[model samples]
Target: MNVARLMFFAFMAMSVSSVSFAQDADCEAVAGQRGECAEEAMKAAARVLNDRYEALIDRAGSRYIFQYQSRHEEHKAFLDRLKNSQRAWIMLRDSNCRLEGFENEWDKPSYSADLNRCTAKMSLERALYLDGILPAH
Candidate 1:
């Protein structure tokens, strides 16, 4: 009985160790995937925003060509500034993600967690910027 119990405990210990190792591996994989996910989401957001902004600009162009007094000139200017800010925001997000992902002092999961958070925040900011432009539509 004692021998059997010892064998069981040893098996359990090995099982736990393997699981811990797998967890670390999974964390690394997830971090990479999440980072890419964030970048792609940002790209899509930028693309859509570009189309919408161009439409607005086209509307403005038509108005000007027709010599209509643009009561919406302030709105157009605001959107232009927002577009510029989104460009800068994307730069900030990329730099921050790199900093977070490379923060591996001890080669551990904690560092990967930081990278995951960085990716998430970076992706989330794109939506927030878009919301500012289009207001939850």
Candidate 2:
């Protein structure tokens, strides 16, 4: 109700609404910090893709009662691809972790163990790539 309280609430809302993982950083670093960026990317990508699909669905839904033509069938195809891509990306992110361990394969057990940190690093790099951000060789 008060200004301070309202501001606090607004901050909390913004914090909750804004995802913290999408940043411009090194993909290797993101992959190093979190093996799950692939997962996050998958989710984020799916959301973006799904939004597009949903829009089509809405238009098609107007034609059909519950099911969608361009929306439902098209999404089915997109969803399958998205799942496969997400899984592959996660695997790639996890596999990348091997490098973070000083190239020590024995350092980590599985990618899920440190996927979050690694994913964050990956997300940052992806953000850069999307922004035309390139890494120095």
Candidate 3:
């Protein structure tokens, strides 16, 4: 595989493993209160993810303004790609969580809790990854 594809897979593997570990730890910490805890965690992580995404979009827009006045096309292209990638990631995350939830009965509280935990874990990971790459003001 190409280096970029390999790296992407590696990162995904790490993210999945970390999410699993976090879910276990979170469940243990909450003493069998996974459902409520997962829901709360998912909401908090979503807030962080949205904030980071908006900040990055703002940064990207301002990045090319002063140093490269003639690069409007490039800025627009970057923004388009960023927005597309975020949309794709959200779809992927939802689908993956849905598939994972299939491990349990579809009508069970466990399934909902698992889905929420997965979403929370993935959102937090994505937010941390974005933080690492976001440009400084």
Candidate 4:
């Protein structure tokens, strides 16, 4: 039950549960323009993911300050681990999306759009997963 293994399981569960093909309004509106729509969606999703990540970091810091004030080393270790976990997750997401987008052909006109769509979907899911961690105030 290590952190990385737990994260993998969580990601797998999320991916399985999020198999719907229904596109959001923004994407659907630009159905004929997938590249533009998907790029926008990916940008928006990245913003949301960053916001959630920052919030979690803030929450962790506050907890450390108010609860683990005497355990500085422990808090630092947790932060370091968190940073590594996030980095690993980002790499996994990017690699997974690349594989998904280039499965048939890498030079296809829809490759960029497909990659963006995968990135956007995974980013949103990761954001939601972050939200589920650390209870809100």
Q: Top TM-score: which candidate number?
A: 4
Q: What is the C-alpha lDDT of each candidate?
A: 0.53, 0.46, 0.78, 0.76
Clashes of each: 0, 15, 0, 0
Off by over 4 Å in 4: 1-23
How does model 2 score by TM-score?
Answer: 0.35
Residue clash pairs of candidate 3: none
Q: Which stretches of candidate 1 lie over 4 Å from their true place?
A: 1-72, 104-117, 132-137
TM-score of each: 0.39, 0.35, 0.73, 0.76
**Total clashes in model 4, counting residue pairs 3 or more apart in sequence or in different chains:** 0
lDDT of 1 by residue, 12-69 (tens): 4564345435544554677656444444444444554466456655555555444455
Scored by Cα lDDT, where does model 4 land? 0.76
Regions more than 4 Å wrong, model 3? 1-27
Better of 3 and 4 by lDDT: 3
Model 2, 1-137: lDDT tens digits are 45765565566445423544342233346656444545554456445434544454343445333444445665566556645755676587657754554433445534443444455455434332222211111
Query: lDDT for model 2, on a 0 to 1 scale?
Result: 0.46
